[model samples]
Target: MNNMKNMKVPSGGAASTLAKLGIIGGIGLYAAANSLYNVEGGHRAIVFNRLVGVKDKVYPEGTHFVIPWFERPVIYDVRARPHLVESTSGSRDLQMVKNWTSSPYSSFAWPATYSLSDPWREL
Candidate 1:
């Protein structure tokens, strides 16, 4: 009968609804994953926004959260590490002066000392 045919449900409609739900769920999961992150020990992180510049607050070692696609974290190691300071220059005497110094976190350089002197003295 025409009435019975009209009452029948379209099979494709149910499949389409389920497919849409699945896609939405997948997107939600992806966003949630991106919103969370962890900072390891001896490290710090800075929160940043797409529209704003670096935030003033620094996050220590721990778990943190942010809005996906709108914000991000930049991690930095606060631990003391080795660094080399070096330079080369040609003097008025037609002599080449080269010097280099290495230290852990460059202990000598901390509170950085600067002076104008003969570069050859450090060589």
Candidate 2:
């Protein structure tokens, strides 16, 4: 804990795991490709920092959405990232093309759910 002797935690409950972390760039969520929070029980301090920026990130896996034992649980963005590819070309299935799910034109509908096309728009 000595290393974190000068670290700071959220004051006045401004930081809630249950609450939205922040709105960045636009209305986008505060998503560092990773986050890290160091805790010190003796000093009653929690030092939360983004691992993505750390020089040698201990949390290689990026664990920011953490639920403290006493406080609210940090919320993970289960809302998958979206991509919207616009093309006048023919649909993918017609050409047997496979795009990364992150592709924009990937539609999330009921069709891909109940069948092989669930959540996907195959031409």
Candidate 3:
């Protein structure tokens, strides 16, 4: 215990330098981790910048990068989905008429009109 007390600890500059390095390293690590994003299959991504707003470019499936906090990714499922509609009413002859419709719906073409900040707003 007496021998351990004899060892001098870093007093000022060295300690401060280590602290600075640690903070910078932590910030860098966080930025690195946040800068990357992935878009899965059957999905598409759009970039939204804090300053300029949603960009015109769309990212395809796989990995992509953006400025950490300044930009964000909005993902949308573009795969075709089945939709069904059915209606029953009386026709001009007073006879009951039934109608059924099935369609494939997808949002692949609607990204251009979407706004990241206000999802309901049009671009």
Q: Could you say which candidate leads in TM-score?
A: 3
TM-score of each: 0.58, 0.17, 0.66
**Per-model C-alpha RMSD:** 11.4, 21.4, 7.4
Which lDDT tens digits does candidate 1 get at residues 57-120? 7777899998898888877666666678788888999999998867776664342212211122
lDDT of each: 0.73, 0.33, 0.79
Question: lDDT by residue for model 2 over 56-118, one digit each (tens)?
Answer: 112212333442322221221222346654444447566644444445334542112123222
User: How do these models rank on lDDT, best leading?
Assistant: 3, 1, 2
Flag regions of model 1 displaced more than 4 Å: 1-12, 82-123
Q: What local lDDT score does residue 123 receive in model 1, on the 0 to 100 scale?
A: 34
Worst 10 residues of 1 by lDDT: 111-120
Residue 37 Cα positional deviation in candidate 2, in Å, after optimal superposition? 3.5
Span of 10 residues, lowest total lDDT, candidate 3: 108-117
Question: Any idea how many clashes model 3 has?
Answer: 0
Q: What is the lDDT of residue 78 in candidate 3?
A: 66
Which candidate comes out best when scored by lDDT? 3
